[model samples]
Target: MAKMRACRACHYLTTENMCPNCKSTNLSTSYTGIVVVLPGRKKGEDPRKGSYVASRLNIEKPGKYALKVR
Candidate 1:
């Protein structure tokens, strides 16, 4: 298993040393909860169009995100 880390800038969860989305090295190992966004086009299923979850969490990409950061 890979150790997950949260991006300090975007709170994105990943196991790599740098965030693939933001390409930032600022990551935290201590975080809680996870949010996964499924990609599709529906009435309210599009994250790129700015869903409530994506807006509230400041997430632009559809992937695993950290709900809480410490």
Candidate 2:
């Protein structure tokens, strides 16, 4: 499997060279911690509105994310 890389701009985890979340090309292999934001219960609902982690991290989408990237 391809090793996942974390986006420096948004901290999102992806295998692709570009971050699908923010389209930032700056990615890092040196990262610690992982957070998976699940989708909201209702359709078209924002997860950040209900998820504490998502809200604290300012994440708007549901996906795997790195807690810290270097």
Candidate 3:
């Protein structure tokens, strides 16, 4: 498996050079904790609105994310 890097801008985890979440180039291999946000059951419903972690982290989409990125 390809090692995942954390996005410094949005904390999203990706394997690419740029962050697909925020389109930021600043990525870090040093990060702690992982959170997986799932999409809402209904279409057009945002999981962020209902998820405590997502709301606290200000995540706009559902995906794997890092708790902290250095």
Identify the candidate with maximal TM-score.
Answer: 2
TM-score of 2: 0.95
Candidate 1 structure quality by residue, lDDT tens digits, 1-70: 9989999888988999999989999999999999887664664455856577877886767889999988
Query: Where's the lowest-lDDT run of ten residues in candidate 2?
Result: 38-47
Per-model clash counts, in order, read 0, 0, 0
Model 3 agreement with the true structure over 3-65: per-residue lDDT tens digits: 999999999999999999899999999999999999888876777789999999998789999
Q: What overall lDDT goes with each candidate model? A: 0.84, 0.95, 0.93
Deviating ranges (above 4 Å) for candidate 3: none
Candidate 3 yields a Cα-based lDDT of 0.93
| Model 2 clashing residue pairs (backbone) | none
Model 3 residue 49 lDDT?
Answer: 85
Better of 1 and 3 by lDDT: 3
Per-residue CA lDDT of model 2 for 1-70, tens digit only, reads 9999999999999999999999999999999999999989997688899999999999999999999898
Ranking by lDDT: 2, 3, 1
- Would you estimate the TM-scores of all the predictions? 0.82, 0.95, 0.93
Q: Name the better of 1 and 2 by lDDT.
A: 2
In model 3, residue pairs whose N, Cα or C atoms come closer than 3 Å (at least 3 residues apart or on different chains), thus clashing, are none
